[model samples]
Target: MSFTIGTREILAEPRPLPSKTVRYLVPVLSLIVGLMIGAVILLASGHDPIAAYKEVANRGFLGELPMIGTLVIATPLILTGLAAVVAFRMKIWNIGAEGQLIIGAVAASGVGLALGEHLPGWIVIVLSLLAGVAGGAFWAALAALPRAYLNTDEVISTLMLNFVALSIMNYLIFSSVSFWRDAERLTFPSGRFIADTAFLPRFWGRLHIGIFIAIGAAVLLWWILRSTKWGFEIEVTGDSGRAAAYAGIGVNRKIVSVLVVSGGLAGLAGGLEIGGVMHNLDPRALSLGVGFTGIVVAAVARLSPIGVILVAILVAGLNNSGVGLQTMGIPDDIVLLLEGIFFLCVVGGEWFLRNTIRIGVAGQPVGERSVP
Candidate 1:
């Protein structure tokens, strides 16, 4: 469509499918632009942008320990990103992944404590992970049922559930004398640590097998969505619910199933954190905003399951640099600001990629066209 204001004419035309190169180029360009904008902000605030960036690179990727730390941070992000991806693909806004993760951790921790001392290490780990998954799935089902049958908005339901989940977790350890609480410590409330037998096996320095598990999940999800009938139905429903119903796809069932699966993935992330890293349901340590970061990761990856892994790693690197940035006198908020800016730029890039823009004098023909 074309419009005119004052002496200027503007045109916005729908763009065709972008070539592979263009598809890749847009995100890179957006990221570069985001960084440039951040540099400008840094300079205006009396900081050396170059040094800040260098520090970020050194702490996030250059050193072996830092690189491993980045990977460790990215472990849960991959799962949560996948969780967002699955629901977003079907146009279902499951924003409750945060709550789901908390619930998952709670259930996993419960299982670990119950089985840790009695069972073998591998069995305890397996049962704990399964409990986490089930917990997450069940939590999501609360929102999904209303969304599927009563036409409730999943976004609000899911988002609100996050607080409820957090409250429940806090109540268990902080406010009440629950089983999850460590009774030995009377001065301060603390979560009881699971037995050593429940801990996940580590491969490298502070790195566990969860990374591989996350990657495997991405691969499996990719395959399921690409090669299976269920995946086909999901894509169709996402594209158009009415059309999907016309095609005999059970839209309600798909909605519940997809969201449940998404929640399960997020739950698995919590379970892994407990088994591989925390070994306890410590609310202070668990609430790292990783679930919300997964949403950003999924968006940056354009909802591609495999793409989520790579984007999660990139985002995790930024997070890993937060502590180092502090030593350089940069506030941690700046890192979050940069992430917000980057997400905005990527979203803008998506819009530009889907439309062509042209400008000219009001009475003149659309002279030149620009494609993002």
Candidate 2:
């Protein structure tokens, strides 16, 4: 017996008549589907979605100072999301944002402890902020050098680096109390408070200047990725590496530089969390995993910087609203449940955007006229 194979076999490919409207429409529909799924789960669990949503909105959005609170929570989210977007656009997976953020907090703490009260407050704050950015960038650059020069797996390098950063932070805070530990907090290991000048001034009780910083950074990054020569290089690199190299682009250099910038943004988030809001460094305080959440934001936003801002707000609001929902006999983890659904739907939607699978017998020619 002999077997015959055609040039075009059963396979998935770009749709012959792809709907442009579906590209945008599907993602939006997926979100709605995800929410509906979540609602169904809630109903099955003997809970009322309408009541829960009402409570969530009232407590999270309509409550006193809710808007500012949401913005404040979203600040780090925006920065970290932007950080992920920057590196991801270059096909660099720098998964060490959490570590970079921790190290940034450590660096900012050191600066705050040293010059918070002794030197001019304004000068000290500036130095402290710069130090935080530098520290994060330094950590990212370390992994970047290995990836760019030695072709190392960044996923492993960057992730392991996070443990290193967290360990160092814990060691400094718990082991050496002289510098980092606050004397008054004898019950627990804690760092010193930042300077008054270093503290980002608050408006309307809870909102801080970090809101503006996050927004400004988002706008600036959006502009950079949209209208600059470097932006074009990033877009090109993301689309095709071979194409980039053929175009005389320095792929390795771009990788390293983009990672550094990504790390710096993550670090800046740490600084804002430390100086603008918390005013003290503690590992527990930052255990909220803002970096990881930012990754989700970046993925959901499709790496668009402007979209990052909106997505960050939505995620932040989800978190706060989830917490609020707890008072109504609901668990906060339900929000995470919804997020999981959202992610899966987004993945499915993107898959549909690129290709459509056609059912056919195995070994049959694809896109061919079949004999009846």
Highest lDDT: which candidate? Answer: 1
Best by TM-score: 1
lDDT of 2: 0.83
CA lDDT of every candidate = 0.92, 0.83
Predictions: Cα RMSD each: 2.2, 4.9
Q: Compared with the true structure, what per-residue lDDT tens digits does model 2 show for residues 290-357?
A: 88888878988989999899889877877778767887788889888877887777767787676665
Which 10-residue window of candidate 1 scores lowest in summed lDDT? 363-372
What lDDT, from 0 to 1, does candidate 1 have?
A: 0.92
Using all chains and alpha carbons, the TM-scores for the candidates as numbered come to: 0.95, 0.88
Q: In candidate 1, what are the lDDT values of residues 1-372, reduced to their tens digit?
A: 889989988878877787888888888899899999999999999899999999889998887898899999999999999999999999999988999999999999999999899989999999999999999999999999999999999999999999999999989989999999999886888999999978989887899989999999999999999999999888999999999999999899999999999999999999999999999999999987888889989989999999998989888888899999999899977889998998899878887678767777888767544453
Query: Residue 130 of model 2: what lDDT?
Result: 82
Candidate 2: stretches off by over 4 Å = 1-13, 16-20, 356-372
Steric overlap count per candidate: 0, 0
